[model samples]
Target: MDNVISVRDLRVLDGKKTLVGPVTFELAPGTTTGLCGPSGAGKSTVLRALVDLLPHGLTRDGHLEVQGRPIRYGKGDSGLRSKVVLVPQTPVVFGGSILDNAVFGLRHLVRASREDLRGRVEQALKEAGLWKEVHNRLDTPAQSLSAGQRQRLCLARALALEPAALLLDEPTSALDERSRDTVEESVAALRGSRTVLLVSHDPAQVERLCCRTVRLEHPETMALTSTAA
Candidate 1:
């Protein structure tokens, strides 16, 4: 099978300075691959670069391909992003009920009837492992959910788009142990079905969740190592 996403000599630059990478990797279809490294190794930045969400004034250089199409640099291509969604390190919840949050991204990207949209949201919630808890209370304020649920809700929102790949940036970084476990289980369930690129600073977490890993080193070294987990 073809790779879902591919990066070759990808690097992020701040003015003339290289802030990240000279890293490369391929995300195989239906597999969970970890992008793991120490703090300041630019794991999260790599995720942003893939989706064309790099911060202002920063630019990415090198080849990026989604499915098999080459992505042009310096373009904020909405279509590219829609196919490869990024769920940030911090889960962001907007003002609304649980149902509203789940359908946030889909409402804009998809032109479908209310029933169809609801059906997709329902399926995404189940994929995120949040349906059982929120199905009956979808109308309730999303803020009522705990920290981990909020994160999974963000995941559900992204999943509703039916993106070709998911870029998760330190998904469990902000949760308590129990909440972290819950999120891990949700991610574990995605393996072999959903293409995932998980950015994690926690080696143990990567070990438990990823089939293989791409390790990023500091900019000074400009080296990346790939190994099976």
Candidate 2:
């Protein structure tokens, strides 16, 4: 199969100042790839650039493609984001039941019947390693879930879309050690079935979860390096 995502000479800029990249990499189908570097190395920034979610006033430049079609800087709209779903470092749960949170994107992006959407949500929750814990209480308030559960819930939400690739930005940074382990298990389960680009400051975590890694140099150096795990 072809690469799920391809990026080359990508850069994020604020006016004339270069904030991130000139980085390049590819995510093959069903592989877990890590993006890792020290703080301020623009690891998170690169993920944002990939999904065209850079903060206001910042812009991206370079070659990006999903399934081989080029994505222009400003052309990465809802359609692009749907294919390459981004799960931010912080988990965001809307006001509703757990099932509601999981099916949020599907309700907007897919024109499926309620039963079909429910089935997809169930599958997503399972893939995220969250179904066993919450399947019985899907109608309960989502805010009641613990931090790690909330994070997995967010992952389930992204998974429900059946995205071409998933961009995870420091998904475990905010969780406690135990929670981190749980989330890692969930990520590990995705290895051979999902295309994931994980951003992490913890090298050990990257080593544990990713098959290979892309290392970003300090902002001053502006270099992107890669190695197989």
lDDT of 1 by residue, 36-101 (tens): 777888988989888887789999899989989889997667788789999998999999999999
Off by over 4 Å in 1: 220-229
Candidate 2 residue-wise lDDT, 40-105, digit = tens: 889888998888888999998889999988888885466998899999999999999999999999
lDDT of 2: 0.91
- Give lDDT per model, in order: 0.90, 0.91
Superposed model 2: Cα runs more than 4 Å off: 219-229
Prediction 2 TM-score vs. true = 0.95
Candidate 1 CA-lDDT value: 0.90
Worst 10 residues of 2 by lDDT: 220-229
Where's the lowest-lDDT run of ten residues in candidate 1? 220-229
